[model samples]
Target chain A: MANPVWMVLRGVCRGLHLTGYFCAFGTALFGALFGQPPGLRRMGWGGFGVALLAGAAWFWLQTADFASASSPSAVLAALPLVAGYTRFGWLTLARMGVLLLAMLCAQKRCWKLAAVLSGIGVLGQAWLGHGAAMGGGKGWLLFGCSLAHIGAAAAWLGTLPALALGLRLSQNPRALAENYSRLGLVCVGAILATAFLQYLFLIGRVSAFFTTAYGAAALAKLLMFSVLLALAAHNRNRLTPALPASRAALGRAVAWEIGLGMAVLLAAGVLMQFAPPAMAMASMGS
Target chain B: MRRSLFAGAAMVMLAIAPAAFAHAYLTTSKPSAGTTVRLDTSSIRLSFTEAVQPEFCAVTVVDGMGTHAETGKPEAVPGHDDELTVPVHFQMAGKYIVTWHALSVDTHKTHGTYSFIVGN
Candidate 1:
């Protein structure tokens, strides 16, 4: 276990990193699907830069935590040992490398190529996360669910700014809204399904939910997610259909969605830092 | 906007500090992390802060001579889920390095190595 201050610091780094990574992934993906809008291009690059910085910080904190060293020099000295020896270290390094590659591709204005590269990088996060430790086919299944959950989230939250841009620039705002509404629905469905599967695997019995740290945080995240889903539904069914007339409302809705999305990401950051409830209970039983 | 982003990031990081914990830490050991032992030392024992899976836990001991010094597989004590015991087989001993990898019941994996003198 880490000290309270360090734990919070690490969690924040992880939350911001996920936000940045998803935003970059989403922007690139949208660009690949449509033509690159200048605003979207800028946002993607910005996200890539943020993700890179936050990721490096997270790595630094993890090294310090693992080595039980707090000073900058001490942490740096321990870096090679952690990075060379631990599974967590390898995954972090791999993720950082992918982020760099994605950034380079985005800089080249290679939208589609950037999207593919960044997507791989984004999915690689599943390895650093909790579910990646399970053995055999079960591990792969959980990994798949985690990947889908993140992909859906990236598509929904990351592309909101781009979607807003489309509303401003396109002559047929209503058509654009309609197309996005359909895409949003699919993303929502996938997010819900995959999240549910992950919950099932991590929580096991419902009793563990109230008794474990991971479970409590996970429950909070689920509540936040439900609120986010409601906002999405409103945008998809009511606000989006109103189009140019509802543009202001749509923008506000998306902004709120983004805020809630950040909250959910924060919860997830905390959740990943702990052992799942089921594991804790099993340990207790033994 | 930039300031807000920075502030938001800082706030979230601070807020999560008290809630996160994972992996296992070595709480006790027969030879300990870095200590000198007797020439007759014959086994290595490690006690962790969390219950670990025996199947996924392993300890390897190697002497300063770069030869294998541990024989067979390490096993967790039957009633004590947190303790791992491994037999050490070595005649010549100066310093022996012990490397361990543990997968806690929660599926978190951790590995570390330390050196202990066989004879002082």
Candidate 2:
């Protein structure tokens, strides 16, 4: 078993990396879908910087974990081996490259192109996950599900900050709210659908949900997601119709959604550290 | 539209099989865990649940006297991406321990140790 402290540290780094990537992706996507909002450029740049730094930290930590390296020199020696040889290493390097390209696009104010690159970076995450363990058609299907799951999640959660800014800046808050509400609905549907598929593939049994660390973290994430849904619903149903009059309330709700979304992302990061119950059972049985 | 999308996702989910395993884990060994083996056994072989990177994997065999019995580095078995083998030359082993650390092709790490008695 890995040390608890190191595991937590890795999870935190993973969460930060996801948060940063999602922020950049979301900002670009928002601009593409609903026109660029004021203050988004700074947010996008900040997100890119954070993602780059956190991604480097995540790679370093993963190298140490994989090699069981206790010293800096040992980790340094193992870095080349991991970065050059393993699938995870290759994907991480590729993702960093994509992120860099996305940053360049964002700098040039090519929102649509930036969004595409960042979205691909998000999709590439599927390869680093449990979906990559299996081979053949089933593996491909699982990867598809993972791609949808992450993309929907990034689209919805990542866009919240930009949406908040849009709400603040748009003279016609109602139009902006309606457009986002539609996108939010589609993202939510995709999230739920892919989440169900992932549960079947990863969890398999309800009992394992109670028995495993992965399950507990997943449950925590689900709870946070539920809160986010409620907030979205409140915004879409009650707040949007009364937009100008209820902008403050809607803003508070979006802020809450953002906080809860971050929590969910962090839980997801920690959850990936544990073997999914189905996988664990299969290993033990074999 | 949302309903159609959900229905489509449901159909896809029902069509797919659940994933069997993730991360490489030792499933079985040539000598087998906690079993008695003949001293003539020439190598230690480990079979994992998932394909592992052989170049990044390590396997060591040590006798009860704490002397290394393994002759060379672990190597992938021909046509078996999920298996690793290391040649061993046990001079006179009473009890031998085998420890292995594997990096799954997906880059997850796992390790374990097992012991077997080497008899006449």
Q: Which candidate should be chosen as best, given lDDT against the real structure? A: 2
If you assessed candidate 2 against the hidden native complex, which CAPRI class would it receive?
acceptable
List where candidate 1 sits over 4 angstroms from the true fold: A280-286, B1-120
- Alpha-carbon TM-score of each model against the true structure: 0.73, 0.86
Q: Give a tens-digit lDDT track for model 1, residues A233-277.
A: 888889877888988788788888888988898888877776665
Q: Write the residue-wise lDDT of candidate 2 on B12-111 in tens digits.
A: 8656646557778888888887789888889988988777888789988898779998999999899887889999988895988888888887667787
TM-scores of chain A in all candidate models: 0.91, 0.95
DockQ of 2: 0.38
What digit string (tens of lDDT, one per residue) describes model 2 on residues A1-286? 2787788778878888898889989998998899887788888888788888988888899889888888999989999988888877888888878977887897788989999998999888887776666665666777788889999999999999999999988899899999999999999999998898888878876777678888888888898899889889989999999979998888888989989998998898888887777774333212
Residue A275 miss distance in model 2 (angstroms): 1.7
- What Cα-based lDDT does every candidate model obtain? 0.74, 0.84
- Which residue pairs clash in candidate 1? A8-B13, A8-B17, A12-B13
Give the distance in Å from residue A180's predicted Cα in candidate 2 to where it truly belongs: 1.4
For residues B1-120, could you state the per-residue lDDT of candidate 1 as single tens digits? 999997786566344322112355565688875678887777888877556656556788888778988887888788786789998877785878888887654435577777788873
Candidate 2 chain B superposition, TM-score? 0.83
Q: Number of the top candidate by TM-score?
A: 2
